[model samples]
Target: MSMREINFDGIVGPSHNYAGLSPGNLAATRNAGHVSHPRAAALQGLEKMRANLRLGLAQGVFLPQPRPDHAWLDRLHQRYDTASPHLKAQALSASPMWAANAATVSPAADTADGKCHLTVANLMTMPHRSHEWPDTLRQLRLAFASGAFAVHGPVPAPFGDEGAANHMRFAAEHGRAGVEVFVYGERGGPFPARQHREASEAVARAHRLDPARTLFVQQAEVAIAAGAFHNDVVAVANERVLFAHELAFEHRDAFYADLRRLMPEVEIVEVPDARVSLADAVSSYLFNAQLATLPDGGMALILPGEARANERVWTWLQELVAGNGPIRRLEVVDVRESMANGGGPACLRLRVVADPATVDPRFLVDEAKLDRIAEIVTAHWPEAIEPGAIGDPALIAQVEQARAELLRALDLVELLDS
Candidate 1:
């Protein structure tokens, strides 16, 4: 079977808004109370997917969860109201649109039983994200329904689990068995560490990964406090290269040493702390990029528009690509709507290494499908969304109807249920 990594990007929902729910997310906090362009956001995301498909890469799409998500409120025997700040915030969360946090994936090549593994994140750390896993699990299982995959639920909470945002895998090639790196964190400062060490180990064991091929690294508490709530905010990995901030981990040097021992051919491409401080890295989301292996054996950095706009980040990227680096080019995309909520190109996707033929055909993407999805977004999605307007019956009805239209466009009628 042919093998390649499929990037399943979340289709941005019509309820996109800036509620500033994530504590350490600088963009969300900085852009709080701002108006959002739901149609623009969805169209931009679709364009990104189309770009990847044109590159001969395996591109897929994940439908967004219904917004004004009153599921949790219904479970709690409560109704939507501004009785408390948290109550109001939960009803307006659009976090499920960032699919990276949905699950941690282990390629079939890396697992012991020759079956891929997927574990839906608990996401128990933030109020806005707490309700995402159950919905996410349903979608994942339906998409990867073949016996070739084994899907697991999150480790019961009180222990936070932020999926691939805190996970990275490295290998000699995209199709080979690789080393899985699970980054966990500790509570040290104002920001609550979202990924627990126990949760990392639990997922690794559940995936039946080889002990020798799995590793657990602790995220630096300082990074978490500096708005890097997720390890991905400071680090990202491709086939054999790691682009990370110097201070991303608790014991950075030791972690790298262990990684070298496990995978001797691995290359470390670090952004020096002196060049870009942790705060700037978090703010610019320099590390939150998609380092994709292009068809011609060269790598390209798929960056959000913000990275090129940041003086320090863009200057460094230009020099990096100009030199004899593996990253051959930069493809900047406009995911500003998602960027305003503290996620980037990397944040919008869940990567899976598998044979495309084995996955459900409905999840696969093509130019015709992309055009149809875009048509639906342009025709049905809300033009703009204000945080306060989320409580309006018209806005809720419009959002729900837009999501339904998208599902029908993609043949994902199963997700229309509560």
Candidate 2:
């Protein structure tokens, strides 16, 4: 079986709204209370998948998690009507649409058992996202129940794992054995540091990776303080190339030296601070772009439109493409709604290296499947959701029904019980 990287993007849920629940995520806070267009958001995500398909990339999708999580409210002993506004908002959060935080995946080549391993993240730091792992695990199990895969539950709480957002994998090729880098945070000044060091170690162990090939590095406090809540906001890695802002790690030189030692063929593409400051990098999500290996053996940076809007970012990108670099293509996509909510192209996807035939067919997509999903979104998803309308019984009903329609359309009714 040919093993290749398949990017599984999360479908934006009907509950997509701007509540500004994440403290360190600058964009989320800045866009709080703004009216959100769920229909538009989901469509944009689908369009991104379609573009990937056009590029000869394998694309899969994880459906939106059930919203207004009544199970969570029940644990709190409160109904939606009686719960405080804060609790209501948390229960209705659609943050799971960012699948990068869904799990930390170790491909078959990197694990001892020769099976792809996945560990769901316990987003324990943020109240709004802390309850996401259970549903995420359900989806993981259903999609990868083959003997070629092993899915583990989240690292116990207090470790605060944020999954792939803080993880980077470097390999000569997708199916080859590679080095895994886990970036964790210890400090962020006024904002809370989300990914904990212990959590990174725990995930590495759970995946049964060789400690020699696994590296743990601390995130630069300055980057985190500047709203780089996750390392992906400042750096991204694909195969041998490491594209990042210069200040992405606390010990940049040492990390680079270590990476080079482990993988002699590694290529480091550092964006200097003078060229694009940390603030601009975080805001533009320059490093959050998907650095994918194209079928022709070249690379492409699938960037959000914000990167093109930033003069410095766009200029640097044009120069990079014009040069003799591994990254030869720049594919710009519009995921503005997700960008406003603190997620970019990378955040919207979970990268899994496996034989496509091993995954559940329901999770994979082609042009026709996307058309069916888009039709459901247009017909049942709410056109707009006001910040104040999250808890209204009418809106809640609509959100639930919209997800149900998607499940039925995909023949994934089993998820309705999830």
Indicate which candidate wins on TM-score: 2
State the lDDT of candidate 2 residue by residue for 1-418, as single tens digits.
Answer: 9998999999999999999999999999999999999999999999999999999999999999999998888888989988988898899999999999999999999999999999999999998899899999999999999999999999997889999999999999999999999999999979989999999999999999999999999999999999999999999999999999999999999999999999999999999999999988998999999999999999999999999999998999999999988889999999999999999999999999999999999999999999999999999999999989987999999999999999999999999997
Tell me how far the alpha carbon of residue 321 in candidate 2 is from the true structure, in angstroms, after superposition.
0.9
Q: How many Å off is the CA of 341 in candidate 2?
A: 0.7
What lDDT does each candidate get? Answer: 0.87, 0.95
Candidate 2 lDDT: 0.95
Give me the runs in candidate 1 sitting further than 4 Å from their true place.
Answer: 81-86
